[model samples]
Target: MKKISLYHTEIENKDGISGHVRSLTDDAFNQLTSSPLKSVPGTNPEQLLGAALATCLNATLEAEEKRRNLPHQAIVRVAVDMGRDYQGFQFWLRVQVKLPQVDQQEAQEILAICEQRCPVAKLLAKSQNVKIELVNEFGFKEEFK
Candidate 1:
């Protein structure tokens, strides 16, 4: 099954739809405005993408705790690092997991699995591209596709 669906919508009104997006799922909670700098405060498009990957890392680690069943002495923390450039953006999510009772091999395997399987991490590591489409709503003649 597909885990994510790419959503795109256009609005010309004041502030547009940037402020209207909310958590459609409990798993993915953080969202930010991607409009021009004049309209949004303290943010740009890259920051939002960083938040998405970080959120995924946290959620995946928490879920791994249950899946691994490491007794009562388990703790997990993930450090997400994001680097951006005009050329491209990349993420290096370092998952520092501590499990008291679990063996070293088991812990390593769990961390590796979580890091590789996390959806946002996968997207970022795979170098997903943003596809933009420009449409002219004011059609003088035929429709613009």
Candidate 2:
């Protein structure tokens, strides 16, 4: 198999669970990161991962909507739960998608395609803890204990 690079970027985090994370490819991409266990004034890995999944999946959904000549009204929401497992700390992700412009069956089809196409979703597909759902409304439950 041949591999071709469509895009590449590097991100660096120098201070572990606290401090700053910045992208080497883009100077404007920088953010303060902190531990989720702390009440610090910064974003944590859980939020960041959720944001990435939501953004990437929504963008892929938007592309599919555009191809179908429908209004771009798809919404993607990701909820990440971090907890202790037998091995130590583990994370579970639940992604919900809403496509208001289409019927439930069509929405499910679109979501299926998006799941296969979305980069972030594909990356997380290997994990049994990751879930992708097609919903008419958003109602995320609390999973952390």
TM-score against native, each model: 0.43, 0.95
Taking the candidates one at a time, how many backbone clashes does each contain? 0, 0
lDDT scores in order:
0.50, 0.93
- Candidate 1 lDDT by residue in tens digits, 30-101: 444554436555444445554665466657766777776644444433333445678885544433445555
List model 2 lDDT by residue over 1-145, tens digit each. 8999999899999998889999999998899999899998899899999999999999999999999999999999888999998999989999989999999999999999999999999999999999999988899887676
Lowest-scoring 10 consecutive residues by lDDT in candidate 2? 136-145
Model 1 regions more than 4 Å off:
1-40, 71-103, 127-145
Strongest candidate by TM-score: 2
The alpha-carbon lDDT assigned to residue 124 of candidate 1 equals 54
Candidate topping lDDT: 2
Which residue runs does candidate 2 get wrong by more than 4 Å? none
What lDDT, from 0 to 1, does candidate 1 have? 0.50
